[model samples]
Target: MDTQQNTALTRALAEVPGPLPTSGVIHITLPHTDRFTVVGNHLAQHPDLSCTAVGLAVRIQSLPQGAKVGIKALAARCKEGEKRIAAALRELEAHGYLRRVRDRLPSGRIITRTVFCNRPAALLHPRRPAEAPPQPAKPEPAPAPAPVPMQRPAPAPVCHPTAAPPAPEVPVAPVAPPALSAPLFVPRVPPPTAPKAPRRPLPQPGELTPELDRAATTFLSDLHRHAPQFTLSEDDVRRLVPGVAAWLERAVRPDSIRRTLTDDPPQPLKHPAKLLAHRLTELLPPVPPGVDALAALDRPRPRFTVTPFQTCEDCDRAFRSPTPGHCRDCRETRAAYAQAAA
Candidate 1:
């Protein structure tokens, strides 16, 4: 046997005790309970529980109570991705092998705890239909009243008159309208052509220096080479050229920008323009001293002048000299006899 088997055998032999009454001997036992066995069988034969979910449930059961479990930790332990672990955990929860409760602590903080129950759903949570409220008693209808008898009125007398004879009428013949000699022919007119839309003017190259233009072009070319799936339009180029120029103004080399863009971007880029714009903005260096100073000079500054004297706190009136609390007019008028003596 190999070294491992020999070591295990030696340990087993050493652990075997002699025939004597033992005291304070600790015995470890496996779960062999009927409930555990039933749970295992149910997990094995479960229709909705997948193999991964079963494995996750088993792992959760093996762990100690209140163990810290998370998606990343479980993924690393099971040698799988986080998404697969999450999906398996969700499946276990859906199949009644797990239950999650969101509880709030006294500190007003919310936390979610997952509870694993190996027992069947029937024992864990017995289904009891909600009891409906009693309906109100129906009201009694009123009885119908008796019908009344009908009454007839008296008839009036009629007057008789002689009938008049009808007169005879003469018949006339109908006249027909004259028919056209020939049918008129009309020519079909052609539809008018729509006016062509005016083209947008290209950005002036003179706005950017030769070196800046060259750097922008190089950056664009490298971007296309790295991510050929992204197609750059004229508007995109116009929007991005100023950012590139700003980088060049800050003394950032074009090659460095290209390297940063080509570095392992996320696969299946959904919005390349937005991604590129974000990267360019994030990696942009600080403005140079000369540019910052020039900008500071161009910005308008607020002006403030110091006053000659302090204003009174009560009346907010200015004085020639400083006063602690009140102005001269208010100090002369007080609720004391000192003002009367003055």
Candidate 2:
């Protein structure tokens, strides 16, 4: 039953009459006067969304017919951190897009089911008076007087400008008084009969190094300058920084920019556009407790088996797939008509 529904959804999406814009919130037309929007703003805000959420939706929509995906299969496809994957599942469930059933194992770990196409009618076809035709956006009327005006003139000057001065001619004699023996120095008087408050233990000597202090300042300043769109919490800072909270207290510090460049560099990028982007490598801070160690973005690594591959169904030509599906060459030749129609 579930597979049949998935196949229907895939067909509906594949045969959609209009071109689907990928850049913004996607409002997709569904069967039975239903529509759904993949809110782009939400995705942008939560960049940490696991690939699982998106991949699951895509896979379900691509099913040929009568096929149901298990939880483990969905997780394997997502390739995201555990926390993010869980978050994505919860989000889908709360939005009525999924119905999760727990399948507990004897070992105490449980798997969750992913049910698509279970959205209630209330969400899919919400009725709200046709949105009142947007009211044609009437121009605003002139504003009434504000309770407090912005500017007012000062009152007239209180003092008169033309004043007269009087002159005196009489002179007086001066007298000096004699000083006695010098008085003894007085000590500071203590407060009398007051309850003494407990003094706090002197703050344990701050642990700071000169280099760390400078790096921290530079790190924060650069964040404000470059990535002004995003906000980071103290935990974020601690996580980003290698360990400079103590070093800032010391007077001596190294060149912050140099230290960061050496310690945490941006990943090596192949695309020209990505290379030209504002490098996050320079802004990394010392690693704080519980924070993952900072690593350069460009560090090379062996390609994992999870990397996708493709084989042409017609020509039998094999190709390394960057995305999903068969080799592009084979798809072009065999599915050309469908591709053009799509």
Q: Provide the overall lDDT of each model, using Cα atoms, as 2-decimal numbers.
A: 0.68, 0.50
Model 2: per-residue lDDT, tens digit, 1-342?
999999987877788678877787655554455443343444334343455665555555555455655555556765666666566666555544456556889899988754455223234443444454545768999999879756878888788688668678668767654444332221122346768876332111144455565566466545534433333455555544433343343322445543442333344423322221222332333434332333544556778676566666666677777664567776676688887889
User: Judged by lDDT against the true structure, how good is candidate 1?
Assistant: 0.68
Residue 314, candidate 1: alpha-carbon lDDT: 68
| Cα lDDT of model 1 by residue, 118-219, tens digit | 764444343455799999999888877877866867668677677676667767667654543431211122235757656433223335887787778667
lDDT of 2: 0.50
Show the colliding residue pairs in model 1.
none
Judged by TM-score, which candidate is best? 1
